[model samples]
Target: MNSIGDNCTELKKKYDSCFNQWFSERFLKGDTDDSVCAPLFKIYQQCVKDAMKVQHIEFKEIEGDVLGSDKEQKVPPKSGSSSS
Candidate 1:
């Protein structure tokens, strides 16, 4: 795998290990601040998005369904152009 793949994998692990667990615990504890939580959750979501974006992919998690939409969003390389 390339460096981008490695970074994406690491971030995905962090989201699964830390972010998701924290959100679950917080919501269960009845901390209902949708104002703050929504954006934070979105950031966590964007983290997942970003990590996937790193791997030249996109995904959306809507109402318990994870779907891969047709390549509307493009993931450009962090640097440089691809040689033919």
Candidate 2:
């Protein structure tokens, strides 16, 4: 898959390749370390951020947890419940 930023595509590809190799060669073997692809990922991430800025998309807006995982769930009150 291509990156959001055209300029970042190469970096993303490099990171993806490294990650895939690491996952299959190291992670699957129980090595568990992922620093091998960190540098490439950082570069790709920065490029995407720059693209987002050029597109007028605020980073903070997309940084929120879309899954609402940290939110407290509220249960509906029972029909038999009475108000004060």
Candidate 3:
């Protein structure tokens, strides 16, 4: 049982180490119409929670009112925008 726990911890570390590049690759792709990105996002969220658990970090609820809740939902604009 101890060994399994240690292995899981190490794997989580490796996952974290490679996450930046993996995230960039996934996020940089254009229009993933095959609908694969959602699962990757979920896995990334779970991995973050797992790592936080391993590190004994406490989470707090967010306090801000949700932004643009009344607007019709659409994909967020890319980083460079021309809107003035």
Model 3, C-alpha of 33: deviation from truth (Å): 7.7
Q: Write candidate 3's Cα lDDT for 1-84 as tens digits.
A: 121234355554555545555556664675334344445545655765665578776555233455776544577888988777
> Least accurate stretch of 10 residues (summed lDDT) in model 3?
1-10
Residue-level lDDT for 45 in candidate 3: 57
List per-prediction Cα lDDT, in the order shown: 0.54, 0.86, 0.53
TM-score of 2: 0.73
Q: Pick the candidate with the highest TM-score.
A: 2
For 22-80, candidate 1 gives per-residue lDDT tens digits of 56877578865435444444555666566667666645432333346563466667667
Candidate 2 residue pairs that clash: none
Error of 2 at 16 (Å): 0.4
> Model 3 misses residue 24 by how many Å?
12
Task: List residue ranges in candidate 3 displaced over 4 A.
Answer: 1-35, 61-84
Candidate 2: Cα lDDT at 8: 85
RMSD of 1: 13.7
Better of 2 and 3 by TM-score: 2
Q: Could you arrange the candidates by TM-score from highest to lowest? A: 2, 1, 3
Would you list the rank order by lDDT, best first?
Answer: 2, 1, 3
Count of clashing pairs, candidate 1: 0
Q: Tell me the lDDT of model 3 at 44.
A: 55
